[model samples]
Target: MKSILVIHHGQGVGGGLIALLGLIAELKENNRVHVLSIFDGIAVDYIRQTGATVTVAKSRFYAKFYQLFIHSDAAYFNIIDSIRNNKSVILYYLSKYYFAGKELKNIVFDYEIVYLNSIFISDWARASKLAKKKVVIHVREPLSRGLFKFKYEIIRQTINKYCDQVIAISHDNASRLDLQHKTTVVYDPVVTKNRSQSEYKLINRKFKYFVYLGGMARIKGFEQLVESLEYLDENIRIFFLGGESEYASHGLKRLVRQNLDPFFLKNKRLIDKLKKSGKIIHVGLVDDVFYYYENSIAAICPFSKPHASLPILEAFSVGKPVIVSDVKGMEELVDSTNGVFFINSDPESLAHKINEMSQVTEQDYEAMRTACMTKYKQIRERSDSVTSVLNRT
Candidate 1:
């Protein structure tokens, strides 16, 4: 059995953590798996439940540093601002590395392979390389172009230099990062055992709303979804099943307060009306998302950027279709057979697609649902594609 050390960014209940949990479930059957988390959150208990040893460094320095860089838009436009951002980044990392090194020193050499679960945890990959251990970096986010593009470039370069292999969750992520020969694409795994037809039937009777199951940030196309509510039938309701990032939420609130209106005014007004009318519901951060998935008509992932969305896979696992943006990673998972696509950030297009899905006959919907499960099964059966490259060596 292989001795594997998994280094993850934090214990948040996001797609990356869910994917890591699925991988750990696979690895623990024949391997000695130990998880080291950078911070403590909801995922720690879940990881422990997977029968793997779990440890937490409990550091917030990196997360805070990241927030500073991403929130400072002026840094991208001005040299002085960029230099200030760089200085803060350097100082924070220097301190973080010192503490992280001391905390991880005893365990860094214990495993044969150090599996970095996300690019955000590259420091662990660096530490593992310095200890002369094999390292695998998983690039779970499309980081080439965004507020933190400069930071992401540094991370990409670091992984290329220090890691033995890189795993991208989707082809789009791999291509975007320019990780050529050393990278492999492993589509994220879905844990199917948790689902139940009886449970679906029971919970499904409670609600008939459409669902959105991720961060409520602007880049997630939440504003667009809100805008589309205007075009939807008055009886149609949407259940938002996740919380918002504090950074994005704060920025959006500030914009609204200032009357700068980053999102369209009509969209904002429509969202308010929907909320008042009880047509828009926010069910923030539930423990069991499958319950929500089971009850909902369908799932929607409208990220403005390219993303390998977990909600799409989860929806498919539960025999539900999805409406996704026609972007790189999203397009890879959805099509006319299983699900429909809408123009990214276009509310009218998304609304039209929603209406089309609403109009699908019961027989046709069943066919689409079957197609979703078929696609999911095909992905799950690719054993060779899912295996870690370190195992090949």
Candidate 2:
């Protein structure tokens, strides 16, 4: 059995973390797998539950610095704030390098491969190469835009120069980077058993609610979703399944304020109305996502960015349709058969799509639900097996 070290950026309950968990579960059947997480959250416990040894390398300084660098709108202020708040960032890097080097020295003789689960931790890839082990870099996020584009470019260059293989979650993500020759596209796996119509009805008996899952980031279109609530009918309710804490909700508001899109600002009154009406329920970070999926009418993903979303796949796995933004990676996943696509960042368009979904006849809805199952099977069939990608000859 091959011994592998998988280093990940965060333990947040997002697509990347979920995908990593699926991979870990598969890999542990034969290989000796150990996980190193840079940040701790719900995902850490999930990883541990899968029987993989998990190590958390805590660095508040690095975390704060990275957050500020990426999310803060004012570049100058962000740099200043990062310096002021994370004075230990430099020391943290030095300590990380030292610890990583020490860890490599201890395990280099035994571990055959080191897998960098996210591009944010490219340092691990470099360290793994230095230890003369095969380095596999997984580019899960679209890195061509946003504040860390330069850092992502560096990672792409590093992968091109030193890493043995690069895995991208989607073709769009792969096309955006420069490591095409060594890159392999591996869609995240979905394994949900089929449930009978009676079972689905029992779970979905209460409310005809739509669900939104994932981080409440601006790029994920949280603000747009909030804005669209005003245009939605009062009978239409939405359950937000992620964003675990009050801090996360507050931080989302802060980001909205910072990156206030003109369309969102224009529909600010509707946002206020939805807040007061309580139509949008925030069911923060529940352990069982299937409960939310089984109960909801459909899944909604109004992301403005261009990355493949896990919620879309999760919705399909549970035999539910999705209403996603018509953006690059996201649009590639949904078509008229399984789900509806709204124009990206346009609150009115989202509102229209939500209305359209509400009006779907029982017959049409059943057809869409069947399409979701078929699409899920097609995706699973097209995806390269995680084992084949990791255990490459």
Candidate 3:
């Protein structure tokens, strides 16, 4: 059996998890496959659940430890901040062993293949390129996250120079590749839950509410979603189902709650106050997302800036209408007849689109649902397999 390795940087929490699971199912019987990534990974859980022999180099502190010693100087700056805000020194030391254990994995990685997940590595200094063998770089992000600051562009360019291929998830991203000869378009393989028709929690058919799933990032259009709620005609309630601020776009739900403080008063006051006023129903973070989508009339992706998002496609698979930002990446999957597209980051436009679609008859709603279902199947075919790509490489 041909032995292979798949490297992943923690990116889209669900999409990445889905892709890895699908890949293992497809590749395992055909060849021996190995996976290397940080600990507490979604991929690691899926692998363990499937009874596969994969490896994890993660712990609560390992990621930070790796950054401090093995990652780039720029990465170390952030690590120092995390360390200074130290809960404990022994905790930091315990976690930094990513370098100690897996640092030499590339040496014995000799059954044959290598796969790098995105261009997130600054440890290219330590690992040697497999010149005789082909390498695949999976492209999930639009560009390098901290490429310039960490001099990762030099590493990316070196990867471009030495790696055999780069696999991008969308055609729009693939077509613009700087390294045309080595570039390939492999649409992300999205595996969705089979929706049961009878399960929709249409508590009030006429009383419509929309759901937005994922993080509360500015790029995700949470600010515009709140603004759209203000312009809305009060009949349709807007619901946001997501976790709050990890970075710049974090704390938005709190900001919204603070802004509306004068309007109400109660013990569990902030979120409850908003829900009572019917401005925004903050669903908080959920474990099983299908439960929320099945009940919602429409699912939303209102990004202030456009990048391909997984939730919009997931909404389609669950047979719900999607109202999303009309930007390049977001607009690519939508069909006007299947779903509605609104002006990006404009609350009034988002609200208008919601009002228009939420009023559709049950039969009409089902037709749009059917059309979206058709689109989801097409993506699975069009996107090439990562293992298949590596096998060809």
- Model 3 lDDT-worst window of ten: 68-77
Better of 2 and 3 by lDDT: 2
TM of each candidate vs. truth: 0.80, 0.80, 0.72
lDDT of each: 0.70, 0.70, 0.61
Whole-model lDDT, model 1: 0.70
> What are the per-residue Cα lDDT tens digits for candidate 1 across 1-393?
888888775556777777777788888878788888766667888788777888876445544543222221111233444466567557436643575565567564368888888765665556677777788888777755556476766666777888888888777878877878888888877765443323333332343468887645555677778777778765566778676544224575556533543334544564565466555777677656777676777887877766687788889988999988886667678888899999986898998888778778999999999999998898777634434575763
lDDT of 2 by residue, 218-274 (tens): 567776887787788767778776662222235675575446434344345544654
Off by over 4 Å in 1: 58-100, 145-153, 193-208, 245-274, 383-387
lDDT of 3 at 107: 41
Question: Distance (Å) between predicted and true CA of 284, model 2?
Answer: 1.5
